[model samples]
Target chain A: MALDDPRATPPPDDPAAREADAARLIGDERLPCGRLVSHAWEQARAAGDQPDPHMDGCAFCRQAVEGLTALDSTTRTLWAERPSARTVADRVMRAVRAEVRLGRMLPLDDPTRELRIAETAAAKVLRRAADRVPGVRAASCRLTPAEGSTRVTIAMTLAVTLDRPLPGRAAEVRRAVAHAAEQELGLAVSTIDLRIASVLEPLKPTASDEPTLRDGSGR
Target chain B: MTAVRTASVERTAARAALAVPGVSELQPSLRQSLAEAATRVRRTLGSAAPSPETGIHAERAPRTGAWHVEVRCVLDEDRRALDTARDVRESVGSAVDAYATRHGIPGPVTVVVTVTRTTGHRPSHHPGTTAP
Candidate 1:
């Protein structure tokens, strides 16, 4: 926030106030001219939008003034903008989410490029795919990017009816999940590691007994 | 060397990418959205029109003066995702190339496409192709 804080005061006339403002805005580093750019900026600022005596003769001071004035103008312009509260909140939330990073980002295709899909998003797609298999319900789906590669490895837990062979059902679920990742989302699935987490009561066909398709992007 | 407006390149690339089939809409990454927000809060840094660059980011490299453009999208699952992504890359690259030539900007353009989500994949039945 110092980027948009107002500069409404007519440069403070008191010497102490001027020094305080300079201390707030400028850092300790000196310029190439062996003078603090902050001091040059302060001198110009205290003059009330005009150059002080030092700036009239010093090249370093003049150069500093030029930059400081442009920066001030930019600051004022930014402060002048009155964007909607919703817009500001959206930006803040996006930044916060990005910082927290809910899950690792998995690359979609090219590893060299900046093309990636959030792990959570890809998992959702795979989960839905696994759940579509007859008598199978995906308990958990986790996708991990292979070491130094764009391919992805899937580790999923499935709950399925014990009517069919456990290993066969697991294989079917793996195929469905892998197909969804590669065909639906264009993710190169390296290997699928599946675990039979639980046994669900056999489904008594009530309405739709057949496996149904769920869109990868619907959820 | 002529200076090229980064936004102009982004807009052109976005339009070209969207024109390709299977691209449902542009989806900006969290990082891209945050960067755009920061720039807007600070100052309008001569970016292009509002809508087109929503999911596109274009920047010029300082050393070689080359252009790197990235496009993010949510695609239709019915269409082949990899094929569509490849098409998007080519489409964006060609459009940016033409834009550079027209503007007399000298630099190689690199376009990268990412498919973040896909929907409507073979929706519930009628599996494959059949005689019409």
Candidate 2:
């Protein structure tokens, strides 16, 4: 039987006041719908809480609640799913702490925010400088901030022609690059570490090689 | 070929040295130490006055052959000034030796130890007098 049906049996009344109680129980205070849903909604709203309209009147809220309920039901239908309340609480607390730490490490409008930008610019400059140097073939540079100073370390492969004296010139180039970085960027150049990748060899002329032709005519 | 062999040897020697007793830490290279020294000196001079006898100063000298290490540390204990200096020298030397043996390099390790501050008692002032 539907709970709201007027024919539904009411709870047994006290025998001493059965006559008076029956009339009171049948009054407007006795809602047709089941008391469980109504009582829960009233209590939630009385505490200045938002009522889930699925349990009340609004269709949108009802639809949303019904969707969530359907999802839960589907999951349960597929498998027996149960999770401890403590585990959920712990996961939530850990997520909150991690977010707080992340927020502190990267606050908006921090002055140090420019440090990343400056480092990127400096890396580009170093790469350009290394490219200009005759012996350095391909170079990669890293700039790190350390204790009020910046350290730039470079790794590169040297050209075959410059391989013999690369080490000596490498130190000089590092110094020049570091000096340029400090003078131009106003950053304290702490150290410049250089690593040689590999030495390239020039192609040699061979008897089997054919001479190039201009306009399809052999020269 | 010889240069590659030498580099390998030096690396082996450096690793060996690190295993020695009283060795604290081994740096990948000496450039870090030099940079640290520069930082220490800048910080010391930019702040209040250091002690008279033991002010911030960096000394760099060649060790075995190619490697150089710089030490930048504070020294505040006034009574053990000599001990502190000796300890700094020994620690730096040991670290360099450790690195050289590990790398198998036979070069001297140059070490520069700087006493940034002397750890002694601060001068006491009169109870209620204000300096003019």
Candidate 3:
């Protein structure tokens, strides 16, 4: 539901009264809809701000928050269980400093001003666009901006189904990347060189993945 | 009634522009920054203060009392900087309106966003283990 939609939230008033009403509605399991729950949960997780009046006394929201809290705890426990690198921060800082050193700016949309885009941002845009194509994973992307246009070179590893042709998949990825660069960055791609680094086989399902139902029916 | 200064307009514009998701920060030009520094030094010396606008250029229409704002910023991480800048332009009007309402100033405001720089993670040249 839209945030401005009045039906999405209850009026802010006496919490005790609202809670009682929410309890009755929640007993029927129909108080908060999925959209409201998701929005409320995100707001709680991100900013811990409860501006929505319905969140104040809604039992469904309370239950959802409790489940999210439990999930957060479980995720934190899993995170703590993992082995961590002590030098990760130092390595990251070194990499960031290196990137700062190689900061090449690309031309932006503004004609009156000397605004430009970083080459890193352009590469990322191209890479993400190529990766979005089915069965294509972008391995690397390089962007070189000259006087008027940009040259984008991408290396992609493709995972193709046995039925699909290799050339078709590569062409699809190329078009997607070019279109994304044009649409997102307002960049004119003078050249896009796609290198197929590797071809991957699609994963086949195993027999053990079959559903185990008690009544001899898959349902 | 109190008067709203040009500095307040610039601050409001910068805040709204930075609030847009993808905008890394306000990127004031070197000339603008130098001018601001000069104004600061002059203020320290007890002279008539210059307008405190930086990063954004704001001009008021003489007859209409409408504010025209131009903002420069650095884009970060988000590839859709153009779209994000469009969103920032939409936000500026409301931000200026809120500021004006709070300060008892009047009327409609216009905003323009110019992206100065874009920054994101550098793509690795390695044949393997790059981000998928």
Off by over 4 Å in 2: A1-116, A148-163, A202-219, B1-132
Residue-level lDDT of model 1, residues A1-219, one tens digit each, is 122222542356755444434334556568777778767666655565664665677777676667666556544454456455777888879767854553777877665544666676678778887877777778788888888889988999877677777777777777788777877667888889998866666645684563322332211
* Residue pairs whose backbone atoms clash in candidate 3: none
- Write the residue-wise lDDT of candidate 3 on A1-219 in tens digits: 212222222332745334322223333233345545555554554343446666766767766666555444433343433323433444445545644643566654544223345566666677777765555657667766655544333344433333366677667777777776766676656667777665444434563422222333322
Q: Which candidate leads the pack in lDDT?
A: 1
lDDT of 2 by residue, A45-158 (tens): 233355344456644333333433333333333222222455445545554553332211111111232222223334544555554444343345666555433333334333
lDDT of every predicted structure (CA atoms): 0.70, 0.38, 0.57
How many clashes does the backbone of model 2 have? 39
User: Against the true structure, candidate 2 has what lDDT?
Assistant: 0.38
Off by over 4 Å in 1: A1-91, A94-103, A109-115, A205-219, B1-4, B31-49, B124-132
- Using Cα atoms, each model's DockQ against the true complex is 0.20, 0.01, 0.10
RMSD, every candidate, angstroms: 10.7, 27.4, 20.9
Question: If chain B of candidate 2 is superposed on the true chain B, what is its TM-score?
Answer: 0.40
Off by over 4 Å in 3: A1-102, A109-113, A149-163, A207-219, B1-13, B19-79, B86-132
TM-score of 3: 0.39
Best-matching candidate per DockQ:
1
Residue A73, candidate 1: C-alpha displacement in angstroms: 26
